[model samples]
Target chain A: MQDVKAHALLINEVGLHARPSVKLTQLAKRFAATIEIAIAADGPWTDAKSPVKIMRVKAAKGETLYMRANGTDAEEALRALADLVNRKFDEE
Target chain B: MGEQKNVGIVIVSHSAKVAEGAADMVRQMVGDSVPLAAVGGNADGGLGTDVGAIMGAIDKAWSESGVAILVDLGGAETNSEMAVEMMPEERRERIVICNAPLVEGAVMAATEASGGSPLDAVRATAEELMAN
Candidate 1:
């Protein structure tokens, strides 16, 4: 099983609040892989498909988030989520 | 075959503004696809749940998939139960009253509903918030 990983900074001013967390989880649900995210470099990983778990990470702007995906679509999942975060969730 | 059923949600709170705010939050998460309604206060427009209003909102949010009601307090729960009992027997069978935080529960439940989950699954998702 080849797991994929990606890391990106949260540039959105509010980080993963309600709306952003929702967007993140919604995207995560579209993939068949199991995706997880961690805030600190050595922090515990939480389920990416759960909005509550994503919110609990308390990610803030300028902090890096670690994402890992495992399954048939692990690479795609990691790439998409990393891209979303890099885009600052499309926030202005 | 018919399209997948989209479960519905109703938010019940003691204050109208509170209910509306929670509904707005759920809308932000689930977008405009899910059926959702917020009912709060009483006939006089003060704090407390109104059974009539709850029933009305339920009707507005009715669907073949079913409906889940999330309440704020004990009184809201009691009144929600009463409102559910007053609903037609057929409809009552598909309605579930969930004891969860108003805002979080509404958001989670609405998200589940938007995914075309069944009534019980949506209710269970909302109630899961109580454990965390």
Candidate 2:
């Protein structure tokens, strides 16, 4: 099993709200890894595949989200999630 | 059994705004994949449940997987049952009036429906809200 971690800034104007959280969880489910995300560097990590948990994080714009993954596809999962957050979830 | 149809959800409340608001929350989480409709307020836009309005919303949200109806209060429950009875015999069996909080039930039911869950599973998921 592989383990990977990364930190990405939420640049979207609306941050990680309802729609964006759904997008993140849907995308996260596509991976074959155990993914978790946290709003603060040292904050408690929650399951990334759960939209409810992701929404609870309530990470605002410019806030850093720390992500961790463990599984066969951990590296791929972390890479894609980091890119999604960095791109502001492709929002205007 | 190969291509499964997703269950549909209906939000029934005494207030139109409450029904729409709950449906909006479900939309935000599940997007447009789930078939859901909000039924509330009377024909005159007053605070009451309309059997005809509920039936119409059910028609819009109809699916082979079935429809799960979530009501706000007591009267809404009775009205919803009457609305279900008014449905066609074939469609009536698939509809379930869940006993759960309006907003929470709609949200859970919509999420379960989007996953292509069957009628009973969707209704059970929403009704499970009372346990929490």
Candidate 3:
């Protein structure tokens, strides 16, 4: 299947800090999709399932974060991840 | 959730508060999904590590998936080593004392464990922070 892709603004106060990163990875792991995240739409994506890599993304507040996933659950994974970022990780 | 075992984690520090604090961070981030325990201070409640306490913490955090331990200082590492050594030979291989920053390592390890990752992956995730 073609990779599913999505992007959302990092509206949370701290962006991809420890808590949010943990939340993201935990959510990503629930799907069978092989997901990757990038600070920009062009390149340099990292594994969405690794909390450490997600934290290292360091995408600050107001930044746009891109995500893409491959696998049977790709579309669902992208939707959930986009929804998560849109909700500001439920931090606000 | 309890039906699926995740790698357990043990935090060791010279100060009880430090160990407890790290464990608290792990819980706050990962919730109780991963087995966790903290051990610190001497029997007298002084700032020192006790082998018995470490051993107990290991037992408390034990899982067939394995246990990854994080220590703060040299003494804490030494005591953790002794604690691991004292365990049954068969069970010893399942436990590892990670050489990573205590609080960060515990948090990372617990996060990985919460995902039902194996002990090596959990330990690797925790240790990877040291390179940053």
Which RMSD values do the candidates have, in order?
Answer: 2.4, 4.0, 1.4
Return the lDDT, model 3, position A56.
Answer: 87
List, residue by residue over A1-92, the lDDT tens digit for candidate 2: 55588989889999998678767876786787999999876669898876556766788998889998999888888899999888788777
Best by TM-score: 3
Better of 2 and 3 by lDDT: 3
- Give stretches of model 1 more than 4 Å off: A41-43, B1-4
Per-residue lDDT of model 1, residues B1-132, tens digit only: 122368888999999999999998888777877888999999998999889999999999988888899999899999999999999999999999987888998898877676666788788778777774
Report the Cα lDDT for residue A43, model 1.
57
Clashes of 2: 0
Sequence-dependent TM-score of model 1 = 0.87
Q: What are the per-residue Cα lDDT tens digits for candidate 3 across A1-65? A: 88888999998899999999999998998898899999888879899998888888888999999
Compute the lDDT of residue A34 as modeled in candidate 3.
97
List the DockQ of the predictions in order.
0.36, 0.19, 0.81
Report lDDT (CA) for all predictions.
0.85, 0.83, 0.91
Clashing pairs in 1: none
